[model samples]
Target: MLGSVTLLLERLGARTRHLAGSFVYAVGFGIEVARQLVLFLFGKRPAFRVLTLQILFTGVEALAIVAVLSLSLGAVIIIQGLSLLPQFGQAELTYTVLVVVITRELGPILTAFIVAARSGTAVATELGTMVVNREIEAYIATGVNPIAYLVVPRVIGVTVSVILLNVYFNVFGLAGAFFASRPTAGVALWEYVAQLGAVLQVRDLLGSALKSAVFGVIIALVSCHHGLLVEQASTEIPQQAIRAVSRCFVLLIVVNAGLTLVYYL
Candidate 1:
């Protein structure tokens, strides 16, 4: 029994150390990507071209799903808001609810979730496969900086895509909610617009942009870090991909909560 207890404690300690090291590695990865991004901004046409392709893959390719989700969520929120709030003689608060839920909160979080589900896994799997295939080493032998040439473009693309998709999500969501509300509540479009305009603040938009940007940064770093950890075997690719998605989901949620709290405070 004592032996078993000691063994369990050792395993726990190992896991804790691994977790701490991974966190530190992710932070360093983020910093390196940021440094490369600064360079990409200064006059890197090759990086720009790569960034465009990544944007096409991660952003434009993701529009349909984001649109469908936005429309569905907006309709549901509209239906629920109209159904429940009017009974309390608080029909006017519907716009406020929309502003708070769709604009300030769900828009960015949902966009990040979608990007993570779609692009994050793709990044990890692609990179892990490359690593397993020794393609990363080949790049190094060719004197190419894999982090700058490969990873930075992806990081920039995903960050931009997430932020843009968050904007798109909010726009589609608000518009869908307005149209959906019309059939049931008979609310005037102009009135809904006016109410939203009145209730919405600049800080709400800034907070959302900040949240999405930070979430994008986290997702990219986690995915790339896990992908690069593939030291042996092609079988590890899927495992790394899964780790990337799970870590992104957890980190995004935690960061979202922290940012939301800070916004309110």
Candidate 2:
């Protein structure tokens, strides 16, 4: 029993060290990507082909689900908020509540969930397959940066997609509230909108956008890191994918709390 316990502890220590090394490598990958992006500042530079693939994965594929969810969420919020407002005789507060809920909290959280379901799994599985086939080893031999190729494009794509989708979510969700609202209250479209503008500041939008970007980076980095760790066995790919998702969810919640504290506290 003593020998077995010692061996288990040794394994745990090795795994912790491996994770620490992976994080350092991922950070280095992020810095190098920033340097490469600087070269694209020149208008004449050719566009990145990887970005096109990422757009397909992040934007085009995610649009339908985002649209459906945004519309439904907006209608539900208006109905619920309006229903409760009469308790306090302040129905106009619906606009403020809707804007705050959808813009700041729901938008980033929902988009992060969507990204994890769609792009996150794909990233892990792809990189895992590369490892299984020894393609990653070939890249290492050729001096290719898998992190730059796999992670950077995903980070850029998911961040852009989440922000764009959040904008659309606010637009469509706010609009849907009018149609789904009850007949008696019959709040004017402009009235709710005016109330929203009165309450919500530009800072709210920027803050939400930043949250989405953080989600993108965390998911991309975590997914790619696990994928790169895939072992020789085929079973390891799915295991890594699951680990990546679990890590992303935990990190997202922790990050959201930290950001909220920074802003509100």
Cα-based lDDT for every prediction: 0.89, 0.78
How many steric clashes between backbone atoms does each model show?
0, 0
**Per-residue lDDT over 3-101 for candidate 2, one digit per residue giving the tens place of the 0 to 100 score:** 999999999999999989877887876687566555444433333577677777787788888888988898999888888986899877887888788
Off by over 4 Å in 1: 1-13, 43-45
lDDT per residue (tens digit) for residues 94-152 in model 1:
87888889988999999999999999999999999999999999999998888998898
Query: What C-alpha lDDT does candidate 1 achieve relative to the native structure?
Result: 0.89
lDDT of 1 at 221: 82
Ten-residue segment with the worst summed lDDT in candidate 2? 38-47
- Candidate 1 has what TM-score? 0.93
Candidate 1 RMSD computed on C-alpha atoms after optimal superposition onto the true structure: 1.8
**Of the candidates shown, which would achieve the greatest TM-score relative to the real structure?**
1
Backbone clashes (count) for model 2: 0
Clash pairs for candidate 1? none
